[model samples]
Target: MKAAWYGENGGPEVLHYGDIPDPEVGPKTVLVRVEWISIEGGDLLNRIHAAPSSDHHIPGYQAAGIVEAVGNEVTRFKAGDRVVAFDWNGSHAEFFAVPEHYAYPVPEGMDLRQASIVPIAFGTAHDALFEYGGLKAGEFVLVQGAAGGVGLSAVQLAARAGAQVIGTASGEARLDRIRPLGLEHGIDYRNEDIAARCREITGGKGVDLVLDLAGGKGKDLLVKALRPHGRYSVIGAAEGTLPSFDFFELIRKAMQVTGISFGRDMHTPRVHQLLEDLFADVASGALVLPIEREFRLSEVREAHEFVATQHPFGRVVMRP
Candidate 1:
């Protein structure tokens, strides 16, 4: 098999695509012939040795593929079954293995490339908004960095749930792209003030929920923009510094500030049900995965470079 492997932690240039030994399936694992794999920030982290993984690791976490074979204990899936999987690595190659519980059947007529991108960004957004934030319909929701992969997913999901979304981007073009997503307001952080604009959009009541990805001074800004007793969830820091905020402000408003890490614990049975619901939405044409670009498996370095640039309006995938 041809796999992209990194012998040491470094830039995308370290990614090597060549022949490698085939993976051995475990008793609870299913071997998949990967059709598409999604690249994520976590993969970059692992490549740079920032994540707690082995040195020469297969970095991809989400993939859409067909089952080639199943281990002895795998009963739910059979050979030739199409599925999308998450919270596992080794999808950068043509073949990979995962636990049966981690894989879900892809909905009929859904594109495999699009399905590959769902596990990380969409799954995280779904868990953060509904499960953790308890986001209700008709509430004012603020999403910072609303043009990135996870951010865009949150925007669409919140809008689909009948929430009034206020998306914050850095430029007019990105802001323009966010406007048609049923957002009530679009804040260009490069020109407009995010916290003040959020306040104005909510008629001085402030946003009911804030999905903040760009941590920095924005953390403090979100604290000011949130309504009393509002909920705020932070998943990433793509912007400036992450400084300590005023603890008194959170105490005064009785705000709930939580940090979310989309790990195996979050991918519980209940969470898988949410993913299935999302898949249903996709199948019904109510939800869409807006892919900005696609790369081949051999171009793993270039794919990582593209994501690092942060210019894509949607997800990026590697078609194996």
Candidate 2:
């Protein structure tokens, strides 16, 4: 099998594409012939920060394709079944092998390209907003880095549930692109003050919930934008370094901070049902995640670089 891999953590330059041996199918494994791979934020983060367990580590989390083979213990899936699979790594390859529990059946007739991006982005947003953050309808929610895949998913889901959504983007054009998805107020993070804007948008009471996706130096402002005892959902840190909570800050506001790692619950029955519903909605056109660009699997290096520098409006995908 041909795949992209790296021996050590570094920039995109560390990645090299070449032929590698196919992964062995375990008793409960589902082997997928990768068709479409979603370039997740975590993919880029892991390449730069996380150490590879082996010299030939293939890094990626989500992908959709046909099941080329299924383990004898896998009862729900068989060869030729269409599905999306998730693992800690190995999706950045021609053949992706995952445990049966981590694979979700892609609805029949849905485009594989679209199914490739659904589970992680939508599942993460859903869990952060309702399951853990406890977001309620008619409450105000602030989404930092609102133009990315998970950010756009959060905007849509929150709005559909009747919550007022305030999102931060780089500029007017990007914000305008997101408004149709249910952003009530768009804050230009490049020029405007996020905390002040949230206070103004919520009539000085501050937002009821804050989803911090772009954690870095700007994390302090997200905390300040929250109302007293508000919920803060820590999702991702696109800026590379994660933000730390201050002891006094936590004590001062009596706020709730929850770290959301959707992968932790992805193999559960709860997430499976949630993803099924989300997939149906996306296939029916009720939910949309725009693909800003597509690249061949061979161009994995260039694709990773584009995501790191471009700040694309929505998700980017690669075909194998």
Candidate No. with top lDDT: 2
Q: Per-residue lDDT tens digits of candidate 1, residues 1-320? A: 87888777778888888778888989998888999988875676566655535555677778899999999999889999999876556878888888888888898888888788776787888877887889999999999888887888888899989999998888888889877776668888778878899888889999999898877677788788999999989777766345465778879999998778776553478767877887887778686667888899888889988887767777788876
Q: Give the poorly placed runs of model 1, Cα more than 4 Å off.
A: 7-10, 45-49, 240-246, 265-267
Per-residue lDDT over 45-86 for candidate 2, one digit per residue giving the tens place of the 0 to 100 score: 899889897999999999999999988999999999999999
The Cα local distance difference test for each model comes to 0.81, 0.94
Model 2 bad stretches (over 4 Å): none
- Per-residue lDDT for 140 in model 2? 97
